[model samples]
Target: MYTFVLPESSRLQEVSAEVSLEELQSQPLQEMIDQMFAIARGERGDTEKRVMVGLAAPQVGIQKRIIFVDTGVDIDRKNLGHLEVFINPILLKKSSAVVLGREGCFSVDPCLCGIVPRSEIVVVQALDRNGKSHTREFSGMTARIFQHEIDHLEGIRFPDRVGPDGVLHWVKEDEYPEYRKNWQQWKVLCSWSDWCAMKSGKSSV
Candidate 1:
């Protein structure tokens, strides 16, 4: 399965503790980021899904303070790009413009999930694959995914921060799968986009 992006909490088992960019020896963070993009673009696991625009270490079973993203780019059933990143990220700041957004997790169970609250913008610091540090200032969906994956590295899940409007009862969560099983038959699917859609009950892809 498409490199199963959703990792369980304990998947944080033995992470790369080298917070500084220089400490990681494994393919370098930028190379790792490129690998993540490869996984997203269907180069690594072109099994069922044909594209991947984002990925974390745990998605491929690595535990490091890195994720790859193309903040303003979109990859769906149409145009996909190599426009992505190897983010050695730390969320140093955030905006107070709280917005409710639909979200899903590569680590969360059953795959499908709901909307959550997140900062509208963020600034982060991390290194590229070469161990040369780069920082980015991002807003909207890009900021949201950065924070979401960062949380994963620290053993957190999206449902823990869900919005009140999207709260689920056990009964509702159960019902959702059956309804969507039939509904999903006609919808175009993309991990990066559909995860966004899980929150809104519509795909952003």
Candidate 2:
């Protein structure tokens, strides 16, 4: 369904300073969003880096102020079972709670680590990949990823969410399986046993 995707290492387009609807109205926003969904639907590369859950227009070099996210829901493939949808995305409102979480970028390695601070929840308004407008309520990782993508539209990256002294790390994706296996062996993490068994790291559902 798409032909162009921003390379993992490409310099993402910076959101034009003070971009507004006037800018989005003039961009090929719909086409880019369609291409993003096609990439997420696994029509392209085989790596987890490319089949990720979300994207930003800036990442694809269209700096007209837009983003696309597919929270990967409804995947039959276990741990990746996140809701799949796209957001043209404008941050409507946000709660001011600092929720810190691990983040990785397709632009870099799948196994990098950075702490990103985000609202516990958000209310957003945007059009879908179809150009149909809608308002969405998001919380948890879903909210975090969406908010992160929104920042990309504004020329921000996950590391920007880190504090001045925040640290970052990089690990191999192949190692996640062993790490998760050991993590589940002793800790009674919420559904750790089931989730661990279901998630062999094959599908980023």
Where model 1 places Cα greater than 4 Å from the true spot, the runs are: 1-9, 12-16, 25-34, 43-51, 74-83, 163-205
RMSD of each: 8.8, 9.6
Model 2 stretches astray by more than 4 angstroms: 1-13, 16-30, 43-51, 72-77, 81-88, 178-205
State how far residue 23 of model 1 sits from its true place (Å): 3.9
- Give candidate 2's whole-model lDDT: 0.55
Say which candidate scores most in lDDT.
1
Per-residue alpha-carbon lDDT of candidate 2 for residues 1-205, written as tens digits (9 for 90 to 100):
4334333323443553333444335556545555666665562244333246666655555554555565543221234643344445677889888686666566433555455678988888876444567887978777888888888766666755664555444446665444333422322122223222222333332
lDDT of 1 by residue, 22-135 (tens): 555455554556566666565424323323445666667666666766565441223343445554578778988987655554455443555568998898887765667767
- The lDDT of each candidate is 0.56, 0.55
Error of 1 at 24 (Å): 3.9
Worst 10 residues of 2 by lDDT: 186-195
TM-score of candidate 2 against the unseen true structure: 0.65
